[model samples]
Target: MEKQVEAIVEWLRQQLKQSGAKGFVVGVSGGIDSAVVANLIKRAAPENSLGVLLPIYTKPEHMTDSQKVIEKCGIDSLTLDLTESHNVMYSYIQDQLKGKNEFNESTDQLAGANLRARLRMSALYTVATNYNYLVVGTDNAAEWYTGYFTKYGDGGVDILPIVDFTKSEVRELAKYLDVPEEVITKAPSADLWEDQTDEKEMGTTYDRIDAYLGGEEIPEKDKDIIELLHKRSAHKRDPLPQYKRKS
Candidate 1:
């Protein structure tokens, strides 16, 4: 764990130096992935890191956790309320519907959630540009493999330090770094929508998915679920192949 941490830090430092980034701006969602990423950023570049708390109609728990993460890491941070942005976006989309119900309530809710995420990313990018800081992503290997993140939303970032670590490995690193127990143990959620949990939405928990990936003998049902998710998300994991034209 120590070696992994050291290597990651060194790599980030080199990248920052090469890119001439004055600092780093990360979107702290109060989830384990973001918390771990923020902690790592502080450890790697204490003087040049800032965590941004972008809450768009988020729950109090999410806000509380974000504060806890900021306090625990002792890194500089600011809270940006995206309520107005969310409201305006919702209103615009609602007007476009023009009394026609284009989607079910669940689909509409998901769209709103994704809008909030994209709004946060927009704010992060703006800050990054203003401060000449790189936007660090908090996505993990497991989520990336499953296309669990919103494209051009949370997926837009200049750097991703924890992309190689699985969800389980992230918890291990969090423990090693002494992240708050609540943050480490709390239910994994994007908090994009009220009462929405990642595991529930994926139809399987990270443990089962990781085990299957590690070549363990998982139940037939579990394997089916994992395979389905993998197949559906395969496009996100790979880019389109290009063919050479005859010259």
Candidate 2:
């Protein structure tokens, strides 16, 4: 783990040099993945790393945990409360849709939830722009494979530091980085809505995803769920579609 840490730190430095960016900024969601990233960027550029906390209808405990991560990493941090921003933007869209008779109540919940993530993404980019830093993403391998992230939202970032690591591996990295115990042990949640959890939304647990990714045999039901998610989310992992001009 120590060697991996050194390698990642060096890689971050190399990326920064290549991008000509001053540093890196990450949205600290109080989750283990984000916490690990915050620490990593801080190590890579102690003076240049920034942790932005964008809370939109988020739980109070999540904010507290985010603070713990910032303090633990001793990274420069800023907090932006986007609750009102999200409410107004979503409400306006809902109203516009209703007026056009295009509002679908069945998909409303998901729309609002994804709006929160996109809002955070915009806020982080805004701050990063001011600092001339790249926005770092916190998606782990399990989340990446499952397409469990919001496109152009949480998935919209300049770089993903831990996208190759599984959930368990991320937790181990968190521990190695001396991340706060509470943040490390808390159930993983995107905090997109009230009382929402990652496992609940995915219909499966990270343990199962880790096992599947490890090439270990799992139950047929679990395998089906994982494979279906991957198939459905293939678009998210693939490059943007392009039009071809041919003779």
Best by lDDT: 2
Candidate achieving the largest TM-score: 2
lDDT values of the candidates? 0.86, 0.94
Least accurate stretch of 10 residues (summed lDDT) in model 1?
98-107
Q: Which stretches of candidate 1 lie over 4 Å from their true place?
A: 99-106, 240-247
lDDT by residue (tens digit), candidate 2, 1-247: 8988998899999999999999999999989999999999999999999999999878889999999999989999999999999889999999999999999999999999989999999999999999999999999999999999999999999988889999999998999999999999999999988899999999999999999999999899889999999999999999999999998
- Which residue pairs clash within candidate 1? none
Evaluate residue 155 in candidate 2 and report its C-alpha lDDT on the 0 to 100 scale: 97
Candidate 1 C-alpha lDDT tens digits along 70-101: 99999899889999989997888877785676
